[model samples]
Each structure stands twice: as structure tokens, then as C-alpha cells.
Target: MHDSKNALSVQKLIADLAGIVRIMDQKDQQLAPAINAPSQSWLETWMTAFWETLCREWASIDQWRMNKVLLLVRFFIREQFGLALEWAVKQDPKLKDQVARQLRVLEAWPLSPRERRVPDGLRLHVLDVWTEELAGQLSAAQKALDEDAENSDPESKKSILLSLAQEFMEPVRKISREAISKGVKIRAKEAVKLAEEQLSG
Candidate 1:
């Protein structure tokens, strides 16, 4: 049985690696063959026990095993970064330009600090990639709002804001407090204010 103390750490490591793999598969056309890959139910069942054994004895694990784990983590970090950059390259240039200015701020947003077995450098890299992805999404949204604002008359813009506030209440509220680009945060705050105004008026 895996030691209770280390179980969470092991699970976190697996989750972190799995998340990277998931994103890689999402962004890489080379992995399209996976759609027809054989089912891995048997492998999944076996690996569960294998990981339990590995984590339970990690403290006294041989040097070779430690090196293997370290190398795997490093390899994934490299691949994840390459794939993330490629994905970003295929995105809209206008939105990418907007997100670029705020990418550093987004990457510095605080995440839950936890004690995990994954190397701190790799963990931070993973977080940066995730934050960049979020910035792209937020920038796209802000640009869309800007386009709508330009196209709509004042009264029509109010209607659009009302609809946006109603549809995106939770996300707008969350983004308003996040370390997103000032423009996006301002847009979110405006939506929130509009929502409140309509509620009171």
C-alpha cells in the first residue's frame, strides 16, 4: 500500500503529468492517431498498482529510479513548452499581440502553493503555459467586446453589455479580481457594473 503521507504527492505528480499530456494531445496533430489507439483499460489497472508501489518506496528508491523520474519530468516540460508555443503561433495575431503585453503578469498570478514531488521548476513552467493559454482566451474575449462596441450604437451597446453581463456573470466576477491584463479586467469590471446598474434601475 502507498504510504498515506505520500499518496497525495504521488497523485499530484500523476495529475500534473497527465494534464501536460492532455494539452499536448490537444495541440499536437501528431497525436491524432491516438483517436484509433487500442483501449488501455488493462494498462490503467496495472499502472495503478505499479504507481502505488513506486510512491510507497520512493524515499529509499535507487538512484537510477530517481534519475528516471527526473528525466521524465524534464522531458515533459520541454515538450509542453514546444507544443504551447506552436499552439500560440496558430492563434489570431491581433489577440496574440494584446495578450503578449500582459502574458508576464498573467503568469505571475498566484496559484495554490503545495508540497508536491514534481520539481519546482517544472511545476512553474507548467503553470506559465497554462496562464498563457488563459491570457489568449481573455484577450480574444476582450477584442470581441471591443469589436462589438465599435459596431454597435450606444443603445445597442447597452443591450450587448446587458446580454454579456447576464451570460458571463460568474466569469466576469472572477476575472475582475484576477491578475489579467488591465484592459480585460476593466472590461469585466464594466460588465459587472452594468449588471448592477440594471439590477438597481
Candidate 2:
């Protein structure tokens, strides 16, 4: 019975994650032009709203559940980071050059002594979104495992988590890659048009 319940919980978490990804994708589509606007700071505002929406959705889940879901969230963030960068560059070619320079700075960004820290304030906000709502999930999972050692296998749970993470990543990756590809082509066309205008003028 406990095994079945745990499996259901895992499935629910997967569905929830999928829902979050879908909502984010929709929000991105609705806000893409604004997010990509060269003169606006809409991306930061959108990210904050996204994080807040995620917090509201997962706020009730216990820490252990939140911790498990967070693995998938991290995967989502990594993939979205690439997608967001691609879309940003697509919006403004000048930013492509600026990003190249920033990459050098990122490579040498100083780190504090903390073992697992996201030094950037924005990334710290992302981390806080997860930690604030699910801070007790890890401990709860550990306690549950301790209390039911015979029924719970930590290795098996780890395997399940990994499997779910991959499942969550694949669709998002596919959609983001498609969007980025389309954005790149659009930007290329725009660049050609701008060049032609300058040459004719």
C-alpha cells in the first residue's frame, strides 16, 4: 500500500512539473516580444513572475516532495537558461556580442566558500523559490525512509528521480529548440534587411 501510494505521489509530481512547464511555455509565448524587446527590462520581471507562480503552485507540497520536484526544476532551469539566451540574442544581435564578453566574466566569477551556492542574485531568487516552499521535503523523505527501511529503497528512489528528471527535460528541450531555431531565422532575415537598407541609403 505504501509502495503504491509513493508511486502515485511520484506520478503526481511528474504531472505537476509538466503542468508548470506548459504554463511557463505559454507565458513565454504570450510575453516573448516584450521579453525580447531590446530597450526593455521585461525579462527580469517575467522571471520574477514565473518564479512567483511556481512558488504559489508548489507551496503546499511538503519539503521532501518539494526536494524531489526540485531536481526536475533544476533541469528545467538549465534548459530554459539556454533557450532564454538564444531568444535574447535573436532579439538583438548586439547582445550576442555582449553575451560573448559576459561569458568570459562568468568563467572567472569569484565564488564564496559555500559548497552549494548560486552567487548571482537572480539565480539565488530561483533557488529561494524552491527552498522557501520545500525546505522540509528532504528531511521528511529521510525520516520516512528511516521509519520504513524495509519498504523504501533509497537507490530505487534515486533512479525514479533521475527518470522523472529526464522525462521533464525532453519535451521542454524540444519546444525550446524549435522556438530558438525559428527565432534565429527571423533574426537573420532582419539582419539582412537592415544591411540592405544601410547599403541603399
> Each model's TM-score, in the order given?
0.26, 0.29
lDDT of each: 0.40, 0.39
**Candidate 2: lDDT of 41?**
29
Per-residue CA lDDT of model 2 for 132-192, tens digit only, reads 2222333343344456657546555434333332332232233223323444334334433
Question: What is candidate 1's lDDT per residue for 1-201, written digit by digit as tens?
Answer: 434454335446656765755543444334334665422322223323433444455577555456556444444434333333333434545323322322322232212123243234333333333333333433444455466645444344334333432432444456566623555455556656655644310
Candidate 2: the clashing residue pairs are 63-136, 63-137, 64-137
Clashes of each: 0, 3
The predictions' CA RMSDs to the true structure, in order, are 15.8, 21.2
Candidate 1 regions off by >4 Å? Answer: 1-60, 92-112, 115-201
- At residue 5, what lDDT does model 1 achieve? 57
How displaced is residue 19 in candidate 2, in Å?
A: 9.0
TM-score of 2: 0.29
lDDT of residue 96 for candidate 2? 46
